[model samples]
Target: MHEDAARAFYAAVDEGAYDQLEELLTPEFVHDRPDQTLRGREAFISFMRDERPLTETRHDIEAVYVGESELAVRGTLRDADDERLLKFVDVHEGEARISAITTYTTQVASRLTEQ
Candidate 1:
């Protein structure tokens, strides 16, 4: 169930289930990515719920690595058409609830920028 938190985070975002997010993340959660750094759960949730450009995308998890107090998930983000937009590794740090997430992403095309 702990490992599921990483997967659930993505599921909640893709499903736009903001309520589920609160259960998975702590109040001081932060998301650090290439494009932006979102501090606090509210800021991260706000971006996912309202500001994310590719709102209809799905995250296909390829692997899950669980550490003592951390988790790393490798996956590809795909559009509704199933086109691979980017490959990513999200490193989540915390114990019971996620406190921070650092994302690394790779893409061949700049298709996302076109959006």
Candidate 2:
């Protein structure tokens, strides 16, 4: 109930569970990111499933905030060896299914994780 969609999203992406991802996203889903914008669920899913640079990675969620019509999550993306790759904040908006997403990311430094 609380940040359920957001949590499901990260899980789906990390595990490459495209079926679950489709169920959680609207047909008109759009993603706006620092590097590029992906329009439509199909396009986004295609990119995630086939074209993304890093496929063997996972998101380690740090926090989630739920609002009336939006949800925001902060997390770090880690490689297969559990090395921190980057930090990201994603703001998602939708009703029953996520319709839109905006992502901000920064490369993580090895020193940050040494502690």
Q: Which stretches in model 2 have alpha-carbon errors above 4 Å?
A: 108-115
Cα lDDT tens digits, model 1, 5-102, are 88888999889999998889899998998876899999988887877767888999999998888888999999889999989999999988899999
Total clashing pairs for each candidate: 0, 0
**How many angstroms is residue 87 displaced in model 1 relative to the true structure, after the best TM-score fit?**
0.2
> What is residue 72's positional error in candidate 2, in angstroms?
0.7
The worst-scoring run of ten residues by lDDT in candidate 1 lies at: 106-115
Best of the candidates, TM-score: 1
**lDDT tens per residue, model 2, 1-115:** 2498899999999999999999999999999987678999999999999887778888999999888999889999888889888899999999989999998889544532342
lDDT of each: 0.86, 0.87
